[model samples]
Target: MKSTVEQLSPTRVRLSVEVPFDELEPDFDRAYKQLAQQINIPGFRRGKAPAKLIEARVGRDAVLSQVVNDALPGKYSEAVTEGGVKALGQPEIDVTKLEYGETFEFTAEVDVRPEIALPAYGDVAVTVDALTVTDEDVEEQLKGLRERFGTLKGVERAVENGDFVTIDLSATVNGEDVEDAKTTGLSHEVGNGQLIDGLDEALVGVKSGETKEFTTTLLAGADAGQEAVVSVTVGSVKERELPEVDDEFAQLASEFDTVDELKADLRERVEQSKKMNQASEIRDNVLEKLLELTEIPVPEKVVQAQADEQIHEVVHQLNHDDDLLAKALEAQGTTREEFESQARESAEKQVRVQLLLDAIADAEDVSVDQGELQEHILFQAQRYGMNPGEFIQQVQQANQLPSLFQEVRRGKGLANVVLEAEVTDSDGNAVDTKAIFEPEGDEADDAEADAAAESDADAESK
Candidate 1:
């Protein structure tokens, strides 16, 4: 096999590969044998057909088709490996020659990781938020967890914010009864912001069996931005009662023997989590600052692709947030198209950062181990409430396995590079980052375990 690459663009490559007949003969022969065993021919039992006779009977085209399918992937991959190309996605292969006795020739056009030269990556002054998980943070987290495990105690008074209300509701668009618009026994928490807007506000000060009508935009489909009159009848209202934050409560919630011990443990966990969030934020700021110092030509195609992703994500996040989306557009001094363009710009910045990191990874030989890859997949799967195996399969089916590895390598490489950087906080103070850099342990591991269980549950649900 022989291979060569032509530079089409900084991010794109055209690879010309040729596999000689000698190298591909074994595959062709194997394909022929496999076909012979399954194919029927007169005057011979299955698997007893002569090779040349079978070729004559079935035609070389049939054999070659099977051979081509089996041979192309390995050959293309081999060429890529031998050429040392770090490609981003799947290749588009064109077979130029593949006759029985002829050498195989093909070309694959693909996106390759762009190379970015390192700017002054050493000592930079950027403020890292100091780890300070307040009592409030711990209390808030505890409250959230308790609410999940909390019992509902019925109320006699009117509905109030923080009270759960079960209601029967219906909507009509311009007085055409939307036959599909009805739900009963719907449990809504006042001010929790799920369901329709103006709903919780309407529910406020309303008691059981009271009907109230309000106008709010439909939160789905083409009618999403259009207003409709909603009729809601409060069936019942209940107040949530949380378990006391005392030693006895701790004993019920966990293995902690005393309330003080539980409180201390909770505080420690919150502090650790806050520091992790802080470190992630620091990395973002550092990368932003570093990007400011680096310059590279931005491909229009790359920018457009990045822009589409951003626009999609932005639309998804804002799909339900009318006020926020409108305010964001106003703040950015742009329309939806303009905001999408800005999103594209943000995406380009990320691409630039990745390019810079890729070059560094190459120079420093950064690589992600199988274990690290598994860890990343597990973490991401858990984030999406998916199973690790399912997530891995999804990535593979999308032909993004290599991209996933590249992402992991990029992250690890950037982390390693920052370690070598002369970094200081925003106040120009040097950071003693050891504590912040340490991994958040066991519970995170347990979260990954939960992810495995969640994956099973997801599969069962599906």
Candidate 2:
């Protein structure tokens, strides 16, 4: 067997392979055995017929066809290995020559990873928003905590914003009642705007036992995109009475015994959350900078696949109803064309990022150990709300373990880039990225334990 490569483009190649007849003996034998089990012979027992006898019965053409079909995959793989081709997707195979007693030749065209000239990781620089916690931030957190501990009490007054109310809602489309849009005793916050449009405005200033009618276009259901007259009856109005900001309130709301202590804890939490946001900003900016510095040739097929997948998911979520999809786009102030264009652009960027990160992983020799892979599997399982054992089985069945491994490797590669890059805050001060990226001792131990448990679960399932 011999193979040579032709570079059709930076991101694609064609492999030309030729295999002599002598090299296909094993394939021929396997094909003959398979055929012998399926074809009957007058004198020989089932599956016991000789290859020559089977060939004579089935004709030489039939035997050659079976052998060729059985030999292509292995031959293609061998050619790919020998040529050091990093094939992306399936190859387009073309059999150029095939003769019984002569040579077999074929050509395969495939997408491949292009050779990328990467910028120095150390030279990459990005600026992120400075981590700042102000009195307003602490006050906001305190307000949230207070709201959580507040008690709702009946108020004999007109409905107001920030008040909770129980209401009965009914809707009609073109003077016909919409059964699915009618409900009673639904509790809603007046200012939340969680229900239909114009609902908040209708509820505001309405007294108890008062009903207000408003017209708005329905965004979902069978009557989607149709104008509906909705009538809301306020059953009761209530206000949240917040506990005073005192030591007694602090003890009731939190573990802290003093209000001052609670405020301090809330401030610390706000600071920590801001730092997390800063780390995220740094990651995004660093990636953007890397993309700006590197030249990654996106494979068209890969980008198309990604875009198709996104569109498929959107359609699936919309129950494959084109009308519903259109209504959704209209509600978002976009059209189908705009959505597709955005999807394509997003897909191209995503493909470029994947390719760039893969190159970085290779350059850094980034590897995912069993523990790290298990940890990632566990995280994904939790995210998707699946049992670890079940998730492992599903991934294994789908043959997605390699993809998962690549994801982890790419993540590590990005982390390496972030570690090496120079990241500073908007105020021109160097940010302490290590504090956000590096796990502390306890967290590391917990992560290891989770990984071990995930591995054990997977082994049990197997």
Candidate 3:
């Protein structure tokens, strides 16, 4: 088979394939034999029909059609390979010419993965959050530790900060008891300012069995937004008794002897966490900067598909919000169209970023460590609350391990670039390496935080 190709676009190509008569001969013979075996001719035994007789009955066209069907796939693949097609999806094929004892030719077009030209991806400087963990951070973690083992003692007085209150809440929207409305024995920490506004204020000065009414936006349930009147009667209130920050408390809370020792250990941990986070942030910034400097072309189909995925995610979240329709219209400027457009933009960015990153990965010979892959798989299984063995089996069964490994390696590659960069704070102060090496709370999703990052990058690139 001989071939020629045309570059329609960075992400698209047109391949012209020509399979010579010599290559078509074997398929012709196979087609004749298969047809002769399947058809019934009186006084003829199976496999006993001659090629010439089969051809006479079926005609040249029929035999050639079968031969064409069998031969096209291999010839098409060969043409694509020889033509250097970096395909994204299945090809669109059109048979231009097909005749016995003549060259068979066809035209194929497809969406291809575009080549990328990165600009200063390595050693790119960026400003990121400082890893100067204060004494307040340590105190906060200590308080959290104390609360974990703290006993809830019934309080005879009004609800206060650090007190857990049990209450029944009812809400109405424009004086209507909406659908999916219900009550629960909800435990709330007074002054948390998380659940709903005015909740802490309503709980204040209230004893057991005392009812209070306050206005707040609904966090959940049917009346999610639009000023709703909430009626709550406190059943009980308990004050949390935290352990003292001492030698004994330190041993119980952590593997340390004294409170000072514990603080020292925690400081080291905090520093490590800060470093990891800074490293991740700087890498992300590098990508952002690279996107700003590079030129990466995005294919339309890829953008559309990505937009659909984003819209689907938004719509799913919308179902859980009561005033979601209004909120979306107000925020996005349209009910669905605007959101879809934004999604398309996001998709384009993602496709371009993936292209560039893949190019970088190729250039640097980036690869995943086997031990790390196993460890990451096990870690994910635990996170999703699944057994490691079962998770590994499922991941393999689904054929998603290769992609997952690629993500891990991509992160590592980004990390390598970040380490070499001259990162600083907003004030242009040089960032400290010891401080930056601390773990940034559980490695947040770069994991998920910047799903739209590439989209912005795509725009900047364009």
Best by TM-score: 2
**Candidate topping lDDT:** 2
Clash pairs (backbone) in predicted model 1: 123-422, 126-425, 126-426, 127-425, 127-426
| Sort order, lDDT high to low | 2, 1, 3
Worst 10 residues of 2 by lDDT: 453-462
lDDT of each: 0.73, 0.85, 0.72
- For candidate 2, lDDT tens digit of each residue in 349-451? 8778778878988998987788778888888799689999999999999998997787777766777787788988889998766666666785564343343
Itemize residue pairs with steric clashes in candidate 2. Answer: none
Better of 2 and 3 by TM-score: 2
Q: After superposition, how far is residue 202 of candidate 1 from its true place, in Å?
A: 1.5
Q: What lDDT does model 2 reach?
A: 0.85
Candidate 1, residue 162: Cα displacement in angstroms equals 2.8
| Model 1, position 432: C-alpha lDDT score | 59
Per-candidate TM equals: 0.69, 0.90, 0.78
Mind giving the per-residue lDDT tens digits that candidate 1 earns over 164-191? Answer: 9899999888886666668999988899
Cα RMSD for candidates in order: 7.4, 4.9, 5.8
How does residue 185 of candidate 3 score in lDDT? Answer: 86
In model 1, which regions exceed 4 Å deviation?
31-70, 95-104, 123-125, 128-158, 221-225, 238-270, 290-358, 367-408, 422-429, 438-462
Model 3 lDDT per residue over 1-462, tens place:
789989998888889888888888888878877987898777789778888788888898888888998988888888878877777767789999988788889998888877776656434667887668889878877788888989989979977776898888777778886455446688888898877678888888888988988876554443444667778888989998887788999889888889999888888878777765665566567677776777787777767777777767766777745367555454433555666676777677777677766676776687666765665675568767998889888999999898667656655555444555677876678875334433365344333222222222323344
